[model samples]
Target chain A: MVRPAMSKEGQRPDPESDADHRAFANAAWSIPSYLLSGMAVYGGLGWLLDRWLGTSALLPIGVVVGLALALYLVYHRYGR
Target chain B: MSARQLLAAEGGNEFQAPGTEIFEWGPLWHGAPSWLTKPTLIVALSVIIVCGFFWAAFSKPKLVPRGVQNVGEVGYLFVRDQLARPLIGKDGDKWMPFLMSTFFFILVMNLMGVVPVMQLPAPSHIAFAIVPAAVVYVLMIFLSIKEQGLVGYFRNMMFPPGLPAWLYVILSPIELLSNIILRPFTHAVRLFANMFAGHLIIAFFATVAYWFLFEKLTPLGASLGLLGFVMTIIMTAFEIFVQALQAFIFTLLAASYIGGALHPDH
Candidate 1:
């Protein structure tokens, strides 16, 4: 929840708070970036593996690995 | 009761059409319904709900939060402190609201299936999931490229710091392709497929359960009905977990994408 305006005579929020909110919004760019990167990497691997192994399973395999890696990082961070 | 009569009772939860696919939207008229079928509608509605809820909470901001604001803070704080902050470190606070909104949006869309009137899971539709998945893809790639430079990012992602020459040759392409091409597609597909399959599972069991309980026209119907009823309940729980799990996975991956982008070497 947002804190009420701190001014006794109705002053504005500290510039820092506005800056902080702006920063949070900007961080959203990563959603598109990593997702694209991961897909490109994983899709390519799937294709390569499919060619080498003669199976369609490589794509799913790559997915499982990617998901695991992502989850691993989350767990590692929160584990603290 | 006859199977026809059993299924004809549309008001009941157990009712199902004989040949219809459960939850299948099969060609809406000539195409699909404009409001419900369009991916934009789903995404827009999700945003509205989340923003509206939060705005309501903060409309009259409070020093000591209460009710909805309190619940909202708990969710936001979890994302900010737990997921985003640690992953992005000091700069993490910047991404909290984005991550928070994304998590709730995806979670609600995923859970739509279990909600009685909203029988369809919006994320089950690839078009809806693809947008966010694509967003994550671009974010990760840009971070890597920005931090490591194109060549450096490629090297960092494809070739690890220490590996034997022979392994390098093998692992290089695998890692390159995996990190570059496949991640976003699968990320989208995973959510889409899970929701799709989930809807189907609910449909299948629901139809069978209904038939067993009411339509078979035999004493054995009662026994089959019990089995189906129990299964329906169990599957409902399973579906709920899957919905939540997919949301967590989506958000976690989104955060990790930022994490990897910020620290490609790690």
Candidate 2:
């Protein structure tokens, strides 16, 4: 299912490869965890920053940045 | 038993909620038998059942399969085709025994919850699920370290091959947190939560049925009891599918972890 998303590059298409299926399964399970961990680590950092600096805005900002980072990480590794 | 008594004690006025006391247990007997608890017994029974089934099936290899072998072959094929081959891809055979035992043991353990006269699922008790998750985590760590030297494993895991160097500082923590900490936690909790909630629902309905129909019998109450009884039956069937599925997923993830350790994405 994910194979069709491969963009038009010079790369040879091996849609039926075992490695492709394995990588697909790995990514399927993995992406959610990446998002969660990104949220957790950055959100915690943001909370700490709020506590230390007496500012309330960092928490939401941190979560957004964390989410973008996580999405970018997934794209760099799997989607691209 | 206590729910009925408590309701009766209330002069049959209001329905008393079934409490968490349902999970509590005293040892089966005094002295050395103190170790004999429902969860403990269920786990042991599940282990024996798994081993016994496989032993019977493959005790003597026949040219043409018989009863036990036929059942065994079906299970073996399921683990191989569905889990090992698709998830692990190459060098998957070596992990078959671990995956096979894990799938069957968990399946049997989960099924025990629905079985009459022994309705407690062992894995629902978080500890049962944690042990396997820990073992798989240890195996994953070990395999990764062994296959790719210690520093290399850590490098590959945290810093995926082609990412810019500066991003590693920001992202390595995410990778570490996800792989090292969260993976095992989720691995154990997924199976545990599913079984726990399934058992809780089944128990709740069963208690309702027993409490309303047998103890406090009334036309209105009997209808609720019948609903409870019907839900109990339906949930039990649903629980069977859930049980098998959870087992399959647990095993599949285990294989995926090992495979990832063996061959990281280049």
Candidate 3:
């Protein structure tokens, strides 16, 4: 039954509380950190695909997709 | 050429023209006397033009402000009251002029995207954003170090005394890292990325509109061309708001950074 604290003026309190700050920090970190990790994964996968397919053009596509996934994940959790 | 046709033919490349990258800095950089490209010239010109407008506007202040004077005053007062004073308080008394000038300077540059013929935002350049960001970064570090002695400042920033030991270990590094690194990076990147993305989007739609109207083969292409033009107009309005908002945000963040420096306790 923990409620997010509100300022006496009824504004949403600033993100300074240990819990609030932790939530924000974790959320922000997870987004960019995971996105970069996702990019690396896709980059590796794309390279493998290019080597197999002999097209050599899927690398950029994979990198972009990886980045997209990372951003999507970040966006999903940022507001909550 | 009419401005629109000229812009379209040149692909809105503001520098000398397409296919040439050489630039002449003249007295600005005496060493190089190269042929300047259109974008660079346009951007530099926009800066001069914007600065000139305010200079002229404020140079002769009337007892009752009129025309450009009124507009300039409004813009100036907006930054002074809403941004610099709120964050910096009494300390802002001296710095308000700097903050106000910087805010409007950036706003004018950002608004250039909406201006005809000069559709480029100067702050779209990393160097442009970096200049203001660097100012804030230096001010933040200076104030922090100055007000609290070097050790005291670092200790205050990294180790707030009230926090529990276990929490301190985890939170301190993050706080320190954010204050030291992420804040400035994000501060600059936020404006840079926003304007970059916005300009690119505008370029994409403009290209689509042009290609459809002039190069494509079908009636549908004509309709889509018009649609693109309409969207461009809509986006331009949004970009105006964004440009001003960004200018404000940059100033606010700068002031906040200064505030943090002045009063590290908060």
Q: What is the TM-score of chain B alone in each candidate?
A: 0.84, 0.93, 0.82
List, residue by residue over B111-176, the lDDT tens digit for candidate 1: 777877566788777777898999988888888889889998887676665556675564455455
Q: What is candidate 2's TM-score for chain B alone?
A: 0.93
Tens-digit per-residue lDDT, B1-266, candidate 2: 34555466556556655565666666855654776888899999999999998889888857577788878877877787677766776567678899999989999999998888788888888999999999999999999999998999999999887877899999999899999999999899999999988888888888788877887789889999999899989999999999989998899889899889988863
Per-candidate fnat, comma-separated: 0.11, 0.54, 0.00
Clashing residue pairs in candidate 3 (N, C-alpha, C atoms within 3 angstroms): B14-B38, B14-B39, B15-B37, B15-B38, B15-B39, B16-B37, B16-B38, B22-B35, B23-B36
Model 3 stretches astray by more than 4 angstroms: A1-80, B1-43
Q: Please, what is the TM-score per model?
A: 0.70, 0.90, 0.67
**Model 2 share of native interface contacts:** 0.54
DockQ: which is higher, 2 or 3?
2
lDDT of candidates 1 onward, in order: 0.67, 0.83, 0.65
Alpha-carbon RMSD, each predicted model: 8.7, 6.4, 10.4
- List chain A TM-scores, every candidate, in order: 0.49, 0.78, 0.68
lDDT of 2 by residue, A3-57 (tens): 2222132132353576887888888888888998999889889999999999999
> Which scores higher on TM-score, 1 or 3?
1
Q: Is candidate 2 or candidate 3 better by TM-score?
A: 2
